[model samples]
Target: MPENMPGRINPEHITIVLNQPRYPENIGSGARAMRNMGFYNLIVVDPENFDLEKVEKLSTHAARDVVEKIQIFDNLQKALSPFNYVVGTTARLGGQRQVNSPSVMAEKLIPISKENNIAIVFGREDRGLSNEDIRLCHGLVNIPTADFSSLNLAQAVMVICYELFNAGTKKKHDFNPRLASCYELNGMYKDLKDVLIKISYINPENPDYWMNYIRKFFTRMNLRAREVGIIRGLIRQVNWYGQKMYKDGLDHKKNQEADL
Candidate 1:
């Protein structure tokens, strides 16, 4: 909430999410990592036997405040619902879950973090995120390790926090001045999908399949509000034109004869 530039990271804009963490000490350490990097918002989803006392003890004086402010949720989806940008952390990589290193991710995050509430999610200590859980994320972060890629939950949190914190606070330069909000992007995708379906561009059986790729393509563009509006307007016109020509009630033969 502090007066920052249009595209600078604010602590209030960042959230650290721990999904089903087994140990309270890890949560505490994650909190401690967050505090060290100037982040405070913490969300814990379906944790196991979490103890505030343990968190307080492990987090120590500086990070105790983060422990006190933890928000509990029944599921990952619900916890991340309010955030505009959600980044899932993973050690394993392949398929759709191919992830970027913390430092590389930090560079991409800094701009988005300014205008949106960003959630950086870490999975359980024992097992990492499930495929379904990872699917909900807009992006994924993977820490590159020398031997074993699997990092402890808190250590992964620390690395990401440090990278993001360092990049966010560094020298600021205006980039992509007017980025659209996730809400705006979501709306645009919906309208685009609907229009594409109407025009038979999106197959009825697998409409979402093509739309997903389109969404990713546009996401990489980091479209601004005005850019989104321009695309929306074009789609509306196309839809209107298609509807006018293809309406069921239209007597095409009769209309052609009358015109002749």
Candidate 2:
């Protein structure tokens, strides 16, 4: 193993997540890549074909430790719930998909990885992460490629892991404090969405489209747990006040009818 870096990032705090992978060999190779880069934490969500024998064959005896400790999840949301920071990998880019190069993303994660549990998520081989899947991520990373733009699953993992490993070898710096977990952030978003819908601030039929902007705005803030709690409390108060005013209006209408 190479000498440990003096940076703030703790390899143990960083996790590599594979979402709906189709092949066990890819999974094995991905694990091997992670092991080569000094990362051992691995999580797979809803794999289509998970043959341990094939996986072990590709991963070999060297990465046996990572393969043995792999964590499996039925859904992406559950897989990400415990993380404080989530970075999604994508090939396709367009509206709402703000992507950073692998090196830039790794540098951004250096400080955040000190106190937060970080998850680097890679999508399926055939199709990368969907719009909905991207919504769960705080940021996106794209590995620069030739015109082809497509990379093998393990290749992508290796590219990202290498960037992270290389970045961690730099000098240490002041680390960022602990941030809000996905569970807390998701709950706050749900409450805020409900309040916005109730007050007609967002279109109820297509609220997600509007909420996407809201999500991006808050994601930039890098909110802490206390900040999330404060926001949720405000949302609850707004919901209560809206309901009270509606009830008062109905009572006034009833009184007018009885007097008539």
- In the range 1-260, model 2's lDDT, one tens digit per residue, is 23355564578899999999999999999999999999999999999999999999999999999999999999999999999999999988777678999999998888898789999999999998988999999999999888798899999999999999888545556648899999999999999999999999999999999999999999999999999999999999999999999999999999999999
Q: What is the TM-score of each candidate against the true structure?
A: 0.75, 0.94
Residue runs of model 2 more than 4 Å from their true location after superposition: 1-8, 168-172
lDDT of 1 by residue, 72-175 (tens): 99988778766667788887788655578888888888767656788899888878888767656778888888986778888988998888877744456444
Q: Highest lDDT: which candidate?
A: 2
Clashes of each: 0, 0
Could you tell me which 10 consecutive residues in candidate 2 have the lowest summed lDDT?
1-10
Rate residue 253 of model 2 by lDDT: 100
